[model samples]
Target: MKNLLAKKDGELLVSRIYQSESTQFEVKSCLIGGEQVMVIAGPCAVESEELLKETAFKVRAAGAAMLRGGAFKPRTSPYSFQGLGEKGLKLLARVGEDMNMPVISEIMDSEDIGLLADYADILQVGARNMQNFALLRKLGQLNKPVVLKRGMSASIEEWLLAAEYILAGGNSQVILCERGVRSSEPWTRNTLDLSAVALVKELSHLPVMVDPSHATGVRSLVSPMARAAIAAGADALMVEVHPQPEKALSDGDQSLTPRGFSTMMRELEPVARALGRRLR
Candidate 1:
């Protein structure tokens, strides 16, 4: 079979790839693969109503195009704070509605698809479930856009093939996210592969975004990696921002403080402009 995501003499081989269009589509007003470098920022998990709301407002104010929070977190440890479930989803939706920004949340199971679709503008499939064929096929049937994260150990071809699962199921609104992958490196949380950003753009017509926060567990590395992702040709960025990183219930070490997020946004503007993309 021929490669579905390929280009021949500057022409895309597949028209079904959503980002192949000259004009990009909007996910509830936030445009992807457009001239603007879309930014989605929020806490890694929804710990409390007050914290979530505050983080949402802060990220929105800092020029993020959308808000992201985990209602059902998939932690490695059973003792870890495993999100607030439905209540957290409700809070995320309310905060987004109140702030007038699109909201994103992860959906772990097929059963929660309906509930998550109702609350989230974009349904995310975490890295752990990247190759969850059943879940990906189900998400493909949903009307909402899906942000498919690269698996911790998945290769570029494997990642695109996983995306094919969703596209083959008939849903074309799929956004690819590179959140780094597990590696032998001990310094950082994950070894961020920025090359994937450029390679994906060349191979596929899908809008690709990077998760610098998850890519590097160190909060200090988020800004530089985010800049590098954009410079390497990323369509958007999903950063974990919190009012108080130290107090955040999950991934606190990698989460950026409100002030830190603001500074990064400001610094990102020139970089985006240099690449002929606007930073909204």
Candidate 2:
């Protein structure tokens, strides 16, 4: 009883010091069966079924445990290429099942949850919708797991509080994603705060992942930042991969080539192993 109390007290201390969410979540294992760290890789947006399938096949072949695609994209420009919506989601669902992997796609609006949940194994909340409390609460009420990305400008407390909104709503299968934050620097699209990766692991009971592709907004920097994220204690990574990045309609600059992804996967093995984790 004394030891239990002490341990609980220790946890409380850590939470206060680091703004943690209680580090005790059961991270879902790879669907294909492995002790390796989970990797979700695919294109940033679903342009076409053929393109999506091609990228999914290559990434899965390179040992990606899950496939990612943005079915309902939240583009900055109204004139920019919007996603294919329900049709695109159907494609992702089909590809995931046919390819023998789990599917993940972003959720934007509250009304689309039921339809999106029907197809997605994991519902991803993009950084732009991090504080969409209504959506978060709705997700919390669902049975499927949610991958919540930190907002671009939200502080650590606000980020966790957003997660808390979900947790408090009753859903506990939440995965925290550090996808970088808005910063004054113009070199990188966003400043990938890897320190938050380590901090999340230390503070929350939820599995913490990183999105280096969105963080850097450049393909060349994906591998290095991915490695760093793992070193900082990320349980998973959400990377963008495309067969022909230059031809991609959205986020082409940040999507890795098949060869580049394969190389990064090879390099990630050692980092995961060194940290007492394995890479699938």
Strongest candidate by TM-score: 1
- TM-score, candidate 2, is 0.89
* lDDT, candidates in the order shown: 0.88, 0.83
Write out the backbone clash pairs for model 1: none
Model 2: per-residue Cα lDDT over 196-273, one tens digit each: 887656565567889999999988999999999888878789999988889888899999998999999999999988
Question: Which lDDT tens digits does candidate 1 get at residues 1-280?
Answer: 3565554543332233545553356887778887788999999999888998888888888899899999999999999999999999999999999999999999999999999988999999999999899999898787778999999999988898888788778787888899999999999999999998888876777889899999999999999999998899888899998888888889999999999999999989999989888886
Best by lDDT: 1
In model 1, which runs have C-alpha deviations exceeding 4 angstroms?
Answer: 1-23
Superposed Cα deviation of residue 90, candidate 2 (Å)? 0.4
Question: Could you tell me the lDDT of residue 251 within candidate 1?
Answer: 99
Candidate 2, run of 10 with poorest lDDT: 1-10
Worst 10 residues of 1 by lDDT: 9-18
Candidate 2 global CA lDDT score: 0.83
